[model samples]
Structures are given as structure tokens and as C-alpha cells.
Target: MKISIFAGVLLISAALIFLGPDTADATSFDTRHVNMGMKADQCTAVMNEGIRRLNQANTFCKSTNTFLTGDNAYHTGTICRSGERGKVWPQNHNLRISLDIYPLVECNLKNKGAKYPDCDYTGVAYTNRTIIVSCTSDKGGGVPFHIEGNLVKYK
Candidate 1:
């Protein structure tokens, strides 16, 4: 009985040591949320959040914003990562953010292959632009937006 109990305790200790939480898979950061009002406010929120993420991930980053259309229909930007140091760890590649704030007069019920209605054009905008990161290779983030009436909500 004494031998059996000692063996069981050793086995449990070994399992606890081996099955510990993986540190590499636990360094993800959440992007900031911004839901004010108007198109400018929403766009600025996303842009600013992107910049903040880049800075948090690294010390050296080059971000450029460009307006693609009259309204906030589609805007594409890039954050180039270069020359790194310290605890800041970003993916060693250019981070490109392609934003498409739909229902901006271009998306409507009669707009060619329109599926959803005009006024009901609402969903998470930055669902695909997710940021997954660790202290190494796994690191990035995304922002999601929802439009209700004339106000925008950040997810």
C-alpha cells in the first residue's frame, strides 16, 4: 500500500509538470475599440488602433494612410516593420490593412450583386483582420466595426 501511494504521487507530479500551460501560446494582445459617430470618427478609430498595435509590437514601424474614394468606402494602408530591438516583437514583414466600410453609397440593394438590404448593411468590418501573436512568430491583430443607423460601433 505504501509503495502504491508513492508511485501515484510521483505520477501525478510528473503529469502536472509535463502538462503545464505552454508559455509560447499565451502572449496575444487585444486591439482597442472605438465607436464614436460619423464616418470620420469610425475611420480614425480604426487607423489609430492599428498604429497603436504596431507601436506596441515594435519600436520601429512605418504607417501610411490613403483615402481611396469620396466617402469612407475603401481605404488601404500599410505598416512596414523594420529594425527591431527589446521586448517588442512584431512579424518581420509588412502589415497591410485593407479597410472597406461598406454601405457607403456604393453598396445598396440594387448595387449589382447586393445580398443584404441597404439600411440593414451591418456586420463586423474587421473580422478577417485579426491579430494573433506570441513572443515569436505568432503575433498580429484585427479590428471589427458595426454600423447602426448613422452611428458606428466597434467590436
Candidate 2:
């Protein structure tokens, strides 16, 4: 009986460990794709950051849909294949940054290059969470690209 109970406990613990964090994050969630919170200038800067980050890694990437829970971070994804087309990839958690105090009207970008709408997008969550996603072709410099919005919830 003791051994059985210990084994069952271990199984349950393992399940819980895997399920718990996902559930918590899923429950604490919000998302959207075509948000219009950030202005032209703000969007431009966010795109620049995405480009710089991707250049170093030279890989496709996405921003976390969740915004403004902390200093936040973004993640880099693979080369984004045809299969991952039109998917919202959570590159980071909150990547969760939030001004959380004001209307977030200024785009809050401090030191970024000039604004250009060549290719790229930026948006703000209702809670002032910001996300940027964009890309370009290596040769043509005119390859059409689209950003995927990953919206997932824990079960």
C-alpha cells in the first residue's frame, strides 16, 4: 500500500507540474492581431527592434501576445515554414511589458530609428501591452510577409 501510494503521488505530481503552469498562463490571457493602439512612429520603432533581433539570429520570430506583466522578453522561432503560416507564435511571455499607468498614446519608444512603413507592424493591448512582428526577404528585398498572432489558452 505504501509503495502504491507513493507511485500514484508521483504520477499526480508529474501531471500537475506539466498542467499547472500552462493552466495558469492560459487563464491569465488576452490577445488580438489588428490592434490600432500604436501610431505610425511607434510601429516603426518596434519593427526596427524586430529586424535587429532577427538579423543577429537570422531567423523568423514572433512576439508574445501577452503584454506588460514584467520587464518582458521576446523569443526567436525557426525559419517560419509554410506550415507555421498564419499562426500566433508566443515568442515570449508578456515579452509581458505594460506601461499600465497611462493611455499608452505616445508609443513609448525612447531611442529608435526614424519611422517607415515599408514592412512591419506594431500594436498595443488594451492594457498597454505592445508587440511587434515583421520580416523581409534576403535577395529580393520585396518579398511579401505577414505576421502571425498566436493566441492560446490553457486547458
Candidate 3:
């Protein structure tokens, strides 16, 4: 039971840690999000929580008027698992987050490990808002905005 709880935190923390300010300009784009340890079973829950966190972040961004287009793309079916998985100890809500240009990461305390509860992370995220780049330019429809970035790790 104890180990499962601890692992749960680890999974969620990995994603929440990486939420930095948006750095997308004409030159280069800069985005960030958390990355889970591939070896751990916590990857599942981390992915789930990532989505939740992303939604929360998007809401905050909207309220703040950070992005005109608003947040796009979401973590789908992320199940950041705890080390304790299966019937024994499965996470409730896995950590699944989304990466957006209007960045504002609200790191969870779990990422701080057992030491720093006020800890946070900032990972480099990449996304393309325009779905139709070449096609849009050719058809004179302009580029359609899109949002695609790191997906929550599963299995």
C-alpha cells in the first residue's frame, strides 16, 4: 500500500515538473512539460494526470487571456501507473497533461519527491498549430491551427 502511494506520486510528478513559459516566436518555439521515467509502471498514471493538468492549465490560460486561439490538443487515455499496478494497487486518476504555446505549468507536490513539496519542472515541448501548412498555402486557405506534442507514456 505504501509503495503504491509513493509510486503514484512519482508518476504524476514527472509530467507536472515540466511546465515552463511559452517561447514560440518566428525564430524558434519553446515549450515544456514533464517526462516520466520509462522504466517505471507509473507512466500510465502520469499520462492520465498530464491530461487533467493540461485541462486545468488551459482553463487558467483562458481566464488570463494568454492565447487568442486557446489551448489545443489534450492527453488522451493517459494512465500514468504507480509502481503498484493491477488489482493490488491501481492509480485513481493517472497524470496526463497537454502541451500548449500559452504555457503556465502548475506543478504538483508529488514531483518534489519525498523532499521538496514545492518543486516543479519545465520540459521542452514541440507542437504545430497549423495542420494544413503546405496545403493551406497552396489552396490559399491559410494554415489551419493545430496542437500536437508529447503523448503520455503507457505500458
Best model per TM-score: 2
Global local distance difference test of model 3: 0.26
Backbone clash total, candidate 1? 9
1-155: candidate 3 lDDT, tens digit per residue: 99999999997886555421111211121112223222223333443354455564322111100111224322211111122111111131212122223222222333433222122332322233211011112222221122222233332
Task: Please give the ranking of all candidate structures by TM-score, highest first, separated by commas.
Answer: 2, 1, 3
The C-alpha stretches of model 1 lying farther than 4 A from their native spots are 23-125, 135-155
**lDDT of each structure?**
0.29, 0.34, 0.26
lDDT of 1: 0.29
The RMSD of every model to the true structure, in order and in angstroms, is 17.0, 14.7, 21.7
Candidate 1 lDDT over 36-151, as tens digits, reads: 22343244344434556555433322222222222323221111112221122234322322222322211112123322121122222332232211222223322112111122
Specify the poorest-scoring 10-residue window by lDDT in model 1.
76-85
Tell me the RMSD of model 1 versus the true structure.
Answer: 17.0
Error of 3 at 151 (Å): 16
Q: Per-residue alpha-carbon lDDT of model 2 for 16-88, expressed as tens digits?
A: 9766543443332222122244443455455546557446334333333223222222122212222232122
Give candidate 3 misplaced runs (Cα > 4 Å).
1-40, 56-155
